[model samples]
Target: MGVGSSSQNSSAMVAIKSQEDQGSAPDLKPKKKICCACPETKKLRDECIVEHGESACEKWIEAHRKCLRAEGFNV
Candidate 1:
């Protein structure tokens, strides 16, 4: 019983470790690419590049809007 319990614990630990080792895991949805232009939207594009990796122009626009809002901008 002790051995069985230890084995089970070990397996669980392995599974947990594997999950952690996988890191955040890529999103199933396709990632978008950023235009890298558009000054009003480039801030978030640059930030996303630094944060969540490269993203699409649309995503950058969205991120820029969020960033601007967070920064107290009226955008």
Candidate 2:
């Protein structure tokens, strides 16, 4: 009985693992290409960083990240 129960549990675990393996990750394949994902925010972020440096461009950088996240990118 014990061995049979263990075998059933192992099979259940394998089934669960198989489902997880087949599941698609939401952020794995973005709907849009990276370069085209967030053009407006990217432009603002890039220009800000170039003109004022990274530290000064935090707002724009965060904005770009947010935009990318909206577009299904992990950022």
Candidate 3:
């Protein structure tokens, strides 16, 4: 009975530890990218555009704005 009780307790502890580990993991939401259209972000976006090109940065900014709007944020 003692061995059986100890095994059950260890299993419960393992389950609790697993739940805590999962809760502590970082959220999976997409990170905000540099907005090329905004004056404040223009410099950073320009550098990214220079390296990655105009089309890519423009697409990123547009997508980011759309995401903000979807989230009820007034971008």
lDDT of each: 0.62, 0.88, 0.64
Assess the local accuracy of residue 71 in candidate 2 as a C-alpha lDDT between 0 and 100. Answer: 80
lDDT of 1 by residue, 1-75 (tens): 776999999999999999888778643331333332245667656766776766445677686766555444545
Per-candidate TM-score against the hidden true structure: 0.32, 0.64, 0.31
What value of lDDT does candidate 2 attain over all alpha carbons? 0.88
**Residue 1 in candidate 3, Cα distance off native in Å:** 5.7
List ranges where model 3 is wrong by over 4 Å: 26-75
TM-score result, candidate 2:
0.64
Ten-residue segment with the worst summed lDDT in candidate 1? 28-37
Which residue pairs come into collision in candidate 3? Answer: none
Residues 4-43, model 3: lDDT tens digits: 9999999999999998998975544434432423444445
Task: Write down the worst ten-residue block by lDDT for model 2.
Answer: 22-31
Ranking by TM-score: 2, 1, 3
Q: Output the number of the TM-score-best candidate.
A: 2
